[model samples]
Target chain A: MAPSIVVRDVLDREAVRRSVDTALADFLAAKARTATSQPQLGYLSGLLQDFMAGGKRIRPLLCATGWYAVGGGEDPRSVFQVAACLEMFHAFALIHDDVMDNSDTRRGRPTVHRTLAEHSAGRRGEEELERFAHSAAVLLGDLALTWSDELLHEAGLTPVQLGAVLPLLNEMRTELMVGQFLDLDATGGLTDDIEATLNVNRYKTAKYTIERPLHIGAAIAGAGAEAMAAFTAFALPLGEAFQLRDDLLGIYGDPGTTGKSRLDDLRAGKNTTLTALALRGADAAQTARLRSSLGNPLLDERGAADVREIFEATGARATVERMIDERHRQALAALEDSPFPFAPDALAALEEIAHLATVRNS
Target chain B: MAPSIVVRDVLDREAVRRSVDTALADFLAAKARTATSQPQLGYLSGLLQDFMAGGKRIRPLLCATGWYAVGGGEDPRSVFQVAACLEMFHAFALIHDDVMDNSDTRRGRPTVHRTLAEHSAGRRGEEELERFAHSAAVLLGDLALTWSDELLHEAGLTPVQLGAVLPLLNEMRTELMVGQFLDLDATGGLTDDIEATLNVNRYKTAKYTIERPLHIGAAIAGAGAEAMAAFTAFALPLGEAFQLRDDLLGIYGDPGTTGKSRLDDLRAGKNTTLTALALRGADAAQTARLRSSLGNPLLDERGAADVREIFEATGARATVERMIDERHRQALAALEDSPFPFAPDALAALEEIAHLATVRNS
Candidate 1:
């Protein structure tokens, strides 16, 4: 058997990203060409192409790494195609998410619904235009989802490979939707339940964003149980830390850097671990202040500042920082102790990813 | 080889509906049972179950007939499972469609979003509650879509059968979304583009609701190109006729029988073939009256009556009826001339279904 190590190509993040992007572009171009009867499809495909160009490619990178970590086959073409499928699926999730949050912009540009609304400007009354845009955006998201499945089907996996991958993909999708439902249900209401907040983080970010991608790649490589378990051990804590960092950035990061308003979570009253910690530690007066200001639609920067002050005063911010630090350490430790043999370079790559995930601002 | 004729069980529509329902019920029960940590999933599953109970099971019936029409294997179990998947997919489509249309009721009950909004009546302000319900409903729809895929995966089809069906399913979903986009774009305006309206009908209803379901089942039975082509020949006109009948029913059917407000399509300014014909034939004063009244949100019985009068005056209603009749005849003729060598019972079932589809009140 070939050495059970990811090749140099899979380990190179830039190379993987480029290949995945090429796969996506080719698939979408084919779709546009075939849809001659529906010019609207070409327009939507263009929007998707533009929307996709701005992503960090983190999932695709991780997927490729996971495949190599388990000593997948020599040719990486199918891996790249599968990675592109993941990216397309992510596009679907984000488009619907923007519509759900009524977010105005994403990646420093207008959201899909906002762009569509602008496209129809002057065609109808404001309310009708908004309705039309939202509906069209939803349809566009649905198309992306279907197209993602097409990408997977066309990826040319053997029956054995396809069988191994389908269940994991199904679980990941269902888990993401469940997490979304939980998050939507919990929004607009302040909660002091840190455990509940972390639960959401696990399903929405840890499993969906980190663990499953790794598991999928490993499965494609036909990794045994030991490697799969080791991935979970390393992935969960790292994934949580990743989201914890995101929670911090959502409040404290620069808009120019994060490509979103820092105030959105506060205004949406997102029951994040940070906010839950603050609520758990607050005194009566602080609790009252946090409750009133967090979910207020009119919350301004001054209000955000007051909320931040309370966060600091109650030690929630510091505690969350410590939590991130501990989880990051735990992830690195899991990687060190894992039974699955990894090449030296694969080990180093994973460590580098862990740092990037937990320590970044955006 | 077994004769290519569907057995008695496959011909029995009521039995098909029962088996499909059982499959759906069993699958949802497993979902609810496994989602122990998320009680919200249980609630959503219950809602889905209730929602599913009211469906006519037309897709499942067509799927079974299609399978037998191509002389599938003896056991009908896998076909039932696949039929259930189609029904589940239809649920996903309807739930999202309600959100897009902002419709209040479906099947004589509150729409999914409306039901969810009522469930949270006292929890948030009116606007926030609406937002929450819409978001949650979209998530629920997403879940249903995911679960439908799960159903297909779990169905005990050989890999070859799966390979045959996946492309057809993908095409059906993409076509449906494209049709939905066109329909949304055309709404809120009066159009005399009869061909465009028919094109939308071909994709949205004819192909998605009729042709694809039949093709998927036939593919599962390992049907060849000629048989597939025969199904299409029989399905397209029947499907168009079905939608044409629906357009008339939407405007003229009784609320008691249709279980929906007839004013909904008019209020939404749906650009159906019936409406297109009306616009094509109306005089200036009649055109102005139709345009003003059709899309008026507050349009009541009196306004609907005026619109109906204009429809009659322009002979739009008569033209639509004649169109349905002509297409229905074409569908029957195609079935008669097909060379696929269907069993006598299977042919009778298709003929019965064609009659039911075009001559229904609901």
Candidate 2:
């Protein structure tokens, strides 16, 4: 076996991001070349390439960090390919998610469906155009997912690694869908079930956005049960903090800073834990106002301000802040409690991520 | 190496169907068990199981026949699981397609979106419920796709077999999406481009429904290039004939026999080869009537009767029938010209499928 590399050097965030981006660009470019027989396919590859350009690459970063923390036993080329696969999969999720929410913008640009609707301009009436745009976006999302599978296959994982990682990958996908279903089920109805909201959060973010990516990277490195369990312990709490902070950013962050409208979640009637906690403690009139205003399709900035005021008045905002702080602490403690002698730099990298996840504005 | 199994007994349609169905049921059962923490997951599993029960298993049958025709070198158990994966993938495609078309009935029962809408009734008003149903159905399709991947991974193919099959499987999915995009782009507009209609048919049916499944199954058995070329030559025309037959059934067949509303294609203004041919040969007034009546959301049986009359008057129906006949003949001819020594019973089976495909009413 080769000597273990220093974790921080292996997981240099800038290097990983550049490497993964290059892999994705090269892969899509090859797809475009192969699509020359059907030139229209080149348009799809271009759209996907542009849409993928602006993401933070958070999942890929975590995947690389996980691989490095497990001692980077495998060829970094394969790891980079898998990381690129995660990025493509994230693109798939976001495209479908924007359509499901009828979102108009993502990453400060028109959403995929919106762009398709514009592309389809002058071809149909309003209703037909809307239908075409939505359906076409769904198809695009499906293609991205299939392409993600292709990247994973082309990653050249050994059979044993492929076998180990596939189950976790499938579980991660299924769990995200389940979380989405539950979220859809809960929308349009105000609820005070904080525990239920937390369950959704855990499934949607805690496992999907964090634990599974880490586990997949570790599995690729042939990490054993003890190391895997350690990752679970470290990832779950940190992941929850990640989502809770996202909810906070959705409502309270500056649009210039976050590149998202603070009012969209409130307008969409998202039943986040913060909202549930506020509903739990609200007086009758507050509850009535929330029920009428939260899910209104035309909710404006004034409406959002009112909702935020209620959140503050009920102490939901402060309570959530406390929760994030506690989870962040728990996540850092998990690294200290890990079974393996984790490299000093790996521990520091995770600690920094925990801080950024909980304390940052975006 | 062990002696090869007899092809005919291995591909006994009844035995293949029963085994594939059992694999699907067992897989779903295990999924249900794993979802004990969220009982709603069990409901999704049950809905999928029920939706899967009524299909003709055409793809799985073709796949099993492909493997058997290649001499059944591997364990039949693994082949059956992969066949089941194709069926589940088909389920995913159908569920999303139905949502796109907004169809109410399939296989003599309410579509997945309809069932979900009915299940979600009493919780919201009409429009919200409709949106919820559509979104949830899309999520369900995503789940089915994920589960299909799980099934493929669990099939226990060697690394080489997996490597060979993955690219074909990915290509199959991408081709289907491309065809779907083209079909969506062409809908709501009448056209006389016969070649364009055939292009869609080649991608959507010839490749997706026929060629890829055969290639995947043959790849699993380590079949040589000559055998694969033969499968393609035999599959493409046969698949085209099958789709052409489907077009005929969509317009003229009995609802009782076909289990589909004969008027849907006309109502949706689907630009099939039949419609293209009809438009190509129609006089001015006849063309005007088609433009006005077709794609009218309120198109009824009376309008459909007029369309059918025009189809007959323009000889489009006859032309389509002739096309199916020619393609069916070409398919049989290709089988007869195979480079390898094919099993006698396998040739007979291909002939039977060709006949059933071109001559069927439903």
DockQ (Cα-based) for each candidate: 0.84, 0.77
Model 2 residue A94 lDDT score: 94
- Candidate 1 per-residue lDDT, tens place, B62-140, comes to 8888998998788888888899999999999999999999999898889999999999889889999999999888888
Candidate 2: misplaced stretches above 4 Å? A1-9, B1-9
Q: What is the C-alpha lDDT of each candidate?
A: 0.89, 0.87
lDDT of 2 by residue, A1-362 (tens): 12332344346777777788888998999888988666668888899999998888878877887887888774677777898999999899999999999998888788999999999899899999999999999988988998999999889898888888888899888898899899999987878999999999999899999899888888888888888899899999999999999999999998877768888899888999999999999999999888878888899989889989999999999999999989998998899999877899888877877787788876
**lDDT per residue as tens, model 1, A71-159:** 87888777878889999999999999999988888888899999999999998889999999888888888888889888999888888
Fnat: each model in turn: 0.89, 0.64
lDDT of 2: 0.87
TM-score for candidate 1, residues paired by index:
0.97
Model 1 DockQ reads: 0.84
> What is the DockQ (computed on Cα atoms) for candidate 2?
0.77
